[model samples]
Target: MNAAVLRQIDPGMPAHPNELDRKRIERALGSRQRYRYVSPKVSCVTGGYHIESPCCSRNIDADGGVIDVALLHHDAASATWQVFRKDHRTGAWELHGVHQRLGSVTDVLNADPERVFWQ
Candidate 1:
């Protein structure tokens, strides 16, 4: 991972998504029935968040026991969100899609048209 891309949010600064956006993200993920049993965990980063879930696959050991579901970053200049799915083999994030709203990103994760995020 690039050092710039891994920047951590400053402790004194306000959270990247703020409370309202956080609530929206939580609600979006909550609405998915699949998440009810194995809820995804969300963590704040400098520009956005990382969504991860518990690993139960035979390859779980290789993934450190958790699977990275998605990465969402806000592009302030364009006011849009960039979505990324983990390339588990390489432990890198690959751009999946981009959307104008956070809800749209969650929708794509839920629909998983290409079987990217869920896998």
Candidate 2:
């Protein structure tokens, strides 16, 4: 295969979050007060984390599967965290906020002032 073809086929792996940052992110999400009752689950992804909670609304899904809550990615180059909210209808991740510290991102998720992430 040509170089271009190889590049297209394998775009290369995403930058992995360092252990310290990863642990901090996980702790922030796991200890969210709003989700304490729900017991949110946090999974490490290529460059960030995926958070989900058990579905409670039958109208949304009859199976009661977990629902996407939020996504947080670390941008090593920028030294910042990017927060995203899932659009349930379109299944697309929309950028919500960005912060330099994990605690700031946690505050946004906890407050959810606009009902974006928690909703």
Candidate 3:
């Protein structure tokens, strides 16, 4: 988590679009959200999944959509993370702006932050 990015955002807005697409991305990183919904187009495009990830992390989206976090074997020891917002053709929530999420560096170090998967 960098102070520079946080300073630019309101800290009351969710992360910007296509930053990383990781789930738990909003919370783990720390962002703002009012209400979010998945559109039929987006759902169809993403195969009904509100979020998509090639492999980075797991959790959920601002819309309560299930976005999971995954870790790469090569970066298994890395502690850095990033989150991106999803766009909806359904105009669920206005993509008015963007923001950054800051993970607790202390927590990652103390807990040996492991990749979180959905139950």
Candidate 4:
């Protein structure tokens, strides 16, 4: 994972991502050590509002810390599908600038055919 590529993949530092965008993250990680990752439904402050969409969250141990990857689709604010990953270094589930779409995710994974698998 090149730092440059990571930056390019996630240009905008969006604080909160939609539910749909969080679902498609697994497709990018491919085969990694499976860990319990629950993609909790987004709860809005507005009592009467609900965002119902297919979203997901997956976790992988990168550099001895848990990294979360979430994907969503067709969010109201961000029309285009978005993806993001949370770094476990800050001691909080803060979404870092690792945004990438399903296509880009797949492309990034495919780009490294000989990636060393730790399994």
Off by over 4 Å in 3: 1-78, 90-119
Rate residue 66 of model 2 by lDDT: 85
- Residue pairs in candidate 2 whose N, alpha carbon or C atoms collide under 3 angstroms: none
How close is every model to the real structure, measured as TM-score?
0.74, 0.72, 0.18, 0.28
Candidate 4 lDDT over 1-119, as tens digits, reads 64345547886633233333334433434433332243223332221111221223212343333232332233336433332333334533332223234456435433434331111
Q: What C-alpha lDDT does candidate 2 achieve relative to the native structure?
A: 0.74
Least accurate stretch of 10 residues (summed lDDT) in model 3?
Answer: 39-48
**Per-residue accuracy of model 1 over 93-118 as CA lDDT, tens digit each:** 99988899887888887777565766
In each prediction, how many residue pairs overlap at the backbone (N, C-alpha, C within less than 3 A)? 0, 0, 9, 12
- Candidate with more favorable, higher TM-score: 1 or 2: 1
- lDDT, residue 43, candidate 3: 19
Report lDDT (Cα) of residue 47, candidate 3. 11
lDDT of 1: 0.73
Q: Rank the candidate models, highest lDDT first.
A: 2, 1, 4, 3
- Residue 82 error for model 2, in Å? 0.6
lDDT per prediction?
0.73, 0.74, 0.28, 0.33
Compose the digit string of candidate 2's lDDT tens values, residues 62-91: 677788988889897897989999998899
Q: Rank the candidates by TM-score, best first.
A: 1, 2, 4, 3
State the displacement of the C-alpha of residue 60, model 2, in Å, after optimal TM-score superposition: 3.7
